[model samples]
Target chain A: MCVLCGGFVVQEHWTEGRGSTGAASVTVGGGASRERQRDRRDRTAMANRILACYGLKLEDWNGSKYIVRDVKGSSEIVHDLGALWPAVEKLIKKTADPLDPALIGRLQQQQQQQQSGRP
Target chain B: MAANVKIPVIILSGFLGSGKTSLLTRALKQPQLANSAIIVNEFGRMGLDHHLLSRVEERTLLVGGGCVCCSMREDLVNACMELLEDMQRGAKPRVDRIIVETTGLADPSPIWFTVLRHPVLQHHFHVESVLVTVDAVNGMLHLDSHDESIKQISAADRVIVTKTDIADGEEIERLRRRIGQLNPAAEVELTDSEDTKSARFFADNPDSVRSPRTRCAMAAADGGREGRSAEDGRNGSGGHTDATHSVSIRFDRPLDWHAFGLWLSMLLHARGTDILRVKGLLDLGGEGPVSLNGVQHIIHPPEHLDGWPDGRRTSTIVFIMKKVQPQQVTSSLLAFQHMLGAVPYVLETDLQFPY
Candidate 1:
């Protein structure tokens, strides 16, 4: 199980893609979609979860595009994140790149290790 | 697992309007790229290229931010995992190759490192090549004006000259020569920005196209600015510019899996803010090396590929952080090693409960 938004929430046995059994109701727990918003991290995780339900491979790279690839094996367990209208609304709306520096920094460090033979 | 499959990623990097995306959209349409996956990193709130590619099988992940080498790397790794998962779950189309179309200001080094260093990612992916796209119409000017541009050229595994349709061929050739001097090993291809399917630029198997001399080029020349960490300045204290950066850690021996996870969780809980990405490739005893990657705070569930994609045996970890001391991180890892019964340490609990 992966913790999202600093473990403020817990999601286990997450559905991998969106199902075709009629669309899921867009209401999140808070009731109002327009007025209420979770913390940024939680919102992004929620978006990830939503993508999971849609059965789409949810991929994000800090900026604007969020990718959803179709899953391969079992159609039942997969949930689609984009299928939930409310979830898509949330992810598309939240825009911030928090892990940018770390991603590049680690890569440069690896290049150094490979060159120097440092384990 | 198809052990015979070798997916070599060719990265097209350059600054905006330099024709990076243009070249990629064109490359995807080529018949040779039929088995390729294209991952695009877009900047800002809206993505443009996601809707531009004509191939349905070309997986697209648009990451918005400063540059892929820094900010959106987790997404890059996660994208790969999801692509694999999708393949396994029968959700997404499967491809034999991959390509990452970077933002204009992207520094190709980090993107390359993600594939080369991340424990989980390193196995399934390889830095087959780094293709830097240069806008010929503004090549010299861009190089003279931007520090990022210089880094792009220096790090390229291949240099592609774009927008030659608008510039004089002689001047474009001169620009090509300049690129060659900066990156002597890279193969330079001049392309008309608008033409995508021209046979002139496409190759059947890009992985086999490198010259023997280029393949044998000095590691120092390819090292670029990343090598400067030891010599550039700042007293060799891992002379890093950004506080939150990624560093890869490796362990050759089989990890005490439980201990390693405990150490990581404790570190993340305490300094998660400073640490942005953590991906490990490890010898988990009987199961082979399992790959795990985390972004910001979300760790994708660990996945096991067939085996090491290459024969290399070091269990590695690439850490992406913010301002935390590398020594502190190293020491903590060392402490974990000692906890693994490899080093002497004073402790109360034998096989501690939490770990």
Candidate 2:
């Protein structure tokens, strides 16, 4: 389960759809098109916000494949919900900066300065 | 001011099997690009062909049938700087232009940012344009299923549709229309077509590429649409829900730069990941026109032009975003402008009336 959104936890190798190997197979469930749309929007928003924390973006394509692109590097296609975490982890490991901790602090300081109307 | 004599750097990007290598191979045969340097970024460990490599020196290799090609051994800045260093040390031939061909799955924006932000590189080089190659046979499918393809198309200054001979004419036409909808300002040309010669790809000046005629056509297209001024609302029906789209905004009068800057910074901060590319020419009051370029979270420092490229002085901004609505961007910008106490001279009614 997602801690922030209480969404269903993704299972490993959970292939549930067809068309194109390595395409994401996770489907959004529930009745009514409006509800389904709303659910998807909410889920995407949540996923995007969480992914930003790790410097990744989740792009859904063809309602079948989830492309996780590194904001600073390459991208990987996630075929199932279970595979998403591992892909993201691999990307983070591949692109992580050694000075990330200091970089985050510097960024926070800059944001605070900007908010306070300082140069 | 002497540093202003910068070599134009063109970015060549495309998805895997989009024929970028083939296009480059053909283009290098031209006399215009003979003295040019190429930085090739290949993904994975497999290297380029051995026959294509003719050992010119340790740092630079002369391709058998083409111009100088250097495999990008490090980050873009380092690679470019190394080339410059080689030139300074008289170890490399004098080159007029540089071309950086990114990996198939790479995003072009970061490379653009690197060129713009690096002090040494920016002094010696300028980003001329972003050229993207799309495979005509598999482009529609790739555009529908790959966000990378969408971003590449959106970020392109020129979209080259390759493999047209193999694909059906109807499929090619459909792909062309989709490209137009995604980036009305992009100059789309078929690779196999007679008009789109290899030498002419990056031959024109940047200002000429985004000419007034292209902007007028884009304005006309957006004007023909209903219920929106900047948005292209193409529904994502069928099985695809997250459709990549573009929004073009035009202002009749000059805008307050401070207000526009704030609004853009906020938008990028909030949804930079979704925004594949943002390119615009802004009319700052009393300051002439300035050009803005951004990709993902990185925004290049604005470049100020001496005067307008064409007769029209209108400010035009094109945003290529994924999953972000046009209304959201327009409304936010309008709201910010209002909060900043900057009243736009032209009204929505004026846009409709056109007189």
Candidate 3:
């Protein structure tokens, strides 16, 4: 159980890895707290790009939790990336096949557009 | 359980006739092992009824995929939990270590998943290593005809080719070569079980395999990974379509932890079973490299080292996989990084990348 808010303990997902306490300095001089927020933003944006394929959005909630919502505005609170994919599959009602050729093609197209500075 | 120490679990796995029991029996003779608990599949299999101290009943858990073998292995996590509780309550003697001897056809993933995923168990127990034994006499035949054998070999941190006393050196060499190709990171040892006190016996250096020494990263030669189908295809599982294969990729710079985690979770959610195991040291540009270890779908909680083991920050990950195309895995990863505008990763074959 958590001691701070007196709530149930949260299982640290593999994705969070070492988390902020043990986090390495990805942003050289950004304080650990700032680096953590930056890390959270990067995750939200990157995940949103992929979820766009399924018409979904992910928001970094308080730099600790994530809210994944579908095009229909249905949302779920995901503890971490470990729970995000399963939550996604439930929202879309389909296998979130990461290797699906179609999904890969979309990512490829977007990557190329970014390379050429295509807005 | 102490906040700083975790009990180590060593898993013994291999084909039905492999010398797992024999090795354990021999090791138990050591006075130091008095504090170790053994979890065998069944008493009949171990033939050590008197040694069976306690039996842990199976408890159904809402974990892992819904498969018959998976459900049975859930009992393994249950066994470990009960053992922990008994020790804590002084009902059972506290063991410094756990030795689990899996069934001949057991897949080590579910047991690993449950151990690493359980909120309570994860804190008290950590898998030290998976020691796989192969009978040197028929090892080649088994590898060529059994998918289970390949899975066991791939998941091993150390592969003991036993029964070498009577087996032909030629056959043993061939089997060892096959194991190396399947899992280049696994150290293969030739052991004549008759020589019970052989230098390669267990407990000499139980930490030998888990020493965080990352394998050298290199591109796999094409066509080296081809699965030898099992003789029986009637099982309808489409079991061994993709031959056991491994690939290692290195990133010149450190990884963006956020992106890496997202990509990995998506991959495991879709194709966890295809990935037999993965190990690596990822530099999140933190104080030290973050170690990553996983068995199929379940990943052990990452440990932040005090410093880089070799004073280098290059990230290298080796994936022991099956049926999954290595190119697709790398391409998707690179694509994710590309979207984040993070440094693009180089792979063995970037051409297979749709971009």
Cα deviation at B342, candidate 2, in Å, is 5.5
Number of the predicted model whose DockQ against the real structure is largest: 3
**lDDT per model vs. reference:** 0.47, 0.57, 0.65
By DockQ, the better pick of 2 and 3 is 3
User: Which segments of model 2 are wrong by more than 4 Å?
Assistant: A1-119, B1-4, B43-73, B193-196, B205-241, B306-310, B339-355
Candidate rank order under lDDT: 3, 2, 1
Task: Please provide TM-scores computed only on chain A for all of the candidate models, following their numbering.
Answer: 0.23, 0.47, 0.73
Compared with the true structure, what per-residue lDDT tens digits does model 3 show for residues B246-270? Answer: 6666676767776677777788777
Ranking by DockQ: 3, 1, 2
Interface RMSD of 3: 7.4
* TM-score of every prediction relative to native: 0.41, 0.60, 0.79
- Candidate 2 lDDT over residue span A5-119, tens digit each: 1123232121121111212345566544554455444444445544555677887766556788986769988653434555665777742221234433443454455568954
Per-residue lDDT of model 2, residues B1-355, tens digit only: 2323567788889999898877877676666666777777653322323212121211222122211111112366666787889888999866767777877777676566556645477678877778899999998787777767877887787889998888999888777767766765577888863333686675554335333223433343233233333222332211342555566677656765544543454355446567776776666664456666666655555655545544567677777777776655554454334323343332221112231
Candidate 1, residue B192: lDDT: 87
Instruction: Assess each model's interface with DockQ, reporting 2 decimals per model.
Output: 0.04, 0.02, 0.35
The residue ranges of model 1 lying beyond 4 angstroms of the native Cα positions read: A1-119, B1-4, B43-72, B194-203, B206-355
Model 1: per-residue Cα lDDT over A32-79, one tens digit each: 433223222333354343234334344443422334344553222112
Question: Which stretch of 10 consecutive residues in model 2 chain A shows the poorest summed lDDT?
Answer: A13-22
